[model samples]
Target: MPRRAEPPARRATVRDVAARAGVSPGTVSKALNGTGQISRATRDRILAAAQEIDFRPNALARSVFERRSYTVGLITTDSFERFSVPVMLGAEDALGAGKISVFMCDSRDDPIREKHYVDVLLGRRVDGFIVTGRIFNEREPLDVSPGVPVVYALTPSSDPGDCSIVVDDAAAGRVAGEHLIRLGRRRIGHITGSAWFDPARRRAAGLAEALGAAGLEVAGDPLYGDWTEAWGRQATHILLRSCPEVDAIYCGSDILARGVGDSLRELGRRVPEDVALIGTDNWEFIAGGARPPLTSVDLGLSTVGRLAARRLLEAIGGNSRAGKEYVPCHLVVRGSTDDLPPASTGSAS
Candidate 1:
């Protein structure tokens, strides 16, 4: 059989366009870019030649004059789990729109792997990096040399001088607590993940603060347990026995809240009617699918990603701001807590 045809030679370039247009490369550039005075006829000729050669301008080469690679490195430690995915999406939305490409790297929380990616991205001349994890806690700074900007997202840098974008866990709990109180549920209880997690502790503290503001205390000392539905169920029993008058419950996560809701129904308590409920994360499927859709606090993880990306860009632009930045969390009201009248449609009588 005849040898396979040679792969289409290399991609066309400015030189090829100039040669085809019977003009110098400098003239081709001036004409195509309209940056310098060039006759309309010559500009049209250069354009036609470029079209014929199928010239695809290299973004890197085109951006060379700006002294930037127009690229970024996005490093994640949680294998892009649910928590990190939204953050990444937000970062990509901001970066890609600015003509900056992102090189995604999953370090899987391995130090060696993270270092390798750092070396490779630096070699590629990435302008900056956004390091993130599933949980928004303080972590050691990346091993890259000084002068390279790295913004932490959903995770903070151990160094107070490094910039970090994180969720406001206290705000999440405060909002949940305030909402429950607004619904006339004064005897509130809080159950959450392990005490080791900053969010868990902060959320619990915030709830207590909100309750305190109203001259009421949490039904009992906040119950700390695993972030699981089973734990939610188990904790509910414990909380009820300890504070039999508990009228509402706030959980650290949606999954745990689901368990709380199930246990409450089994124990002959009506959601919102008897015991209002709230959860964190506001994950749609989990919150919306509940018997009475769960009310939850949205931690705004995506907003954290977006702000982190913006901070990285600012640093790359020579206006670096340091220290931890908190993004506010907001509550999403659903049927689980307050029952409202049906919405009215503008229909003729």
Candidate 2:
């Protein structure tokens, strides 16, 4: 009453692939491992054979032979929030293309936790590391063995010798100021976060620089406060009270801009028609959700992550670069600054 079951098919092996490709096993190994000198034709033939037989190489065995785990450790202090997420995604995109796996760890701003993650990832023999966080301030270098490669993204390492990828904060402000200037807005007010933060100061300086180049000056000194909608609202009233002729306002963040916009509406000032608003970070959700979508500076967070990953890859390959590399910021046009419809997602030139 029982029926016989079919036998399981045998798995494909390197020898089978080599035989099918009419090449020696050694040649197949060379081709698959990307070692030694092999002609393109032979490599292609071996690859084709491996594909035809549905062959999958043993990752562990391959790693052993290559003496590399082909894995990277990504450590973040931002808890994968809005700032770090894009950077992480960009790093993943780059690492994935190299067939490298990533191990994500969150330090949550604790030194002990960061050290523990570093030790564990080192134990796993990850080929390299990418460190990222919310702020652009330089952080202490990651503690690791001498030979291990590490690239800092967004948040730079304090050591001048380490490679760091960062957004150009000054450029963000300069670009915003230039845009407002081009719109014939001579009286532009600056509203932003704390004065102690390096980025906030740099952005304020940049806005001043842009205004200066046009033989003009900001309507008033930059209103420095904590980064919040409430600050934005309060600062707006103050700025208007002192310089009611301010035709434009540039905020350090989209959240601040939203609050500023709300305040402007309450004060019976029409957006664009009366006072154009621009913000930083170009965070789509906050910028897009504003009554009139907010035009903001895109800090190229993803690009920072991608470049950091590339730099790490280079370091792993024995070609490392030191010092800081700044990715440029770009403007994203939106309803608040321009009369045109909302632009598509992501940063624009």
Ten residues in a row with the worst lDDT in model 2? 340-349
Q: Across residues 1-349, which tens digit of lDDT does each residue of candidate 2 receive? A: 7989989999898999999999998999999879889999999999999999999988898889878999999999997488989999999999998889999999999999999999999999999899999877889999999999999998999999999998899999999999998888888999999988889999999999999999999988899998899999999999988888788899999989988998988887878777899999989999989878899999999999899999999999999999999999999998888753222221111
Worst 10 residues of 1 by lDDT: 340-349
Q: What Cα-based lDDT does every candidate model obtain?
A: 0.87, 0.91
Which candidate leads the pack in lDDT?
2
Provide backbone clash counts, one per model. Answer: 0, 0
TM-score of 2: 0.94
The whole-model C-alpha lDDT of candidate 2 against the native structure comes to 0.91
Model 1 per-residue lDDT at 77: 89
lDDT of 1: 0.87
Cα lDDT for residue 206, candidate 1:
94
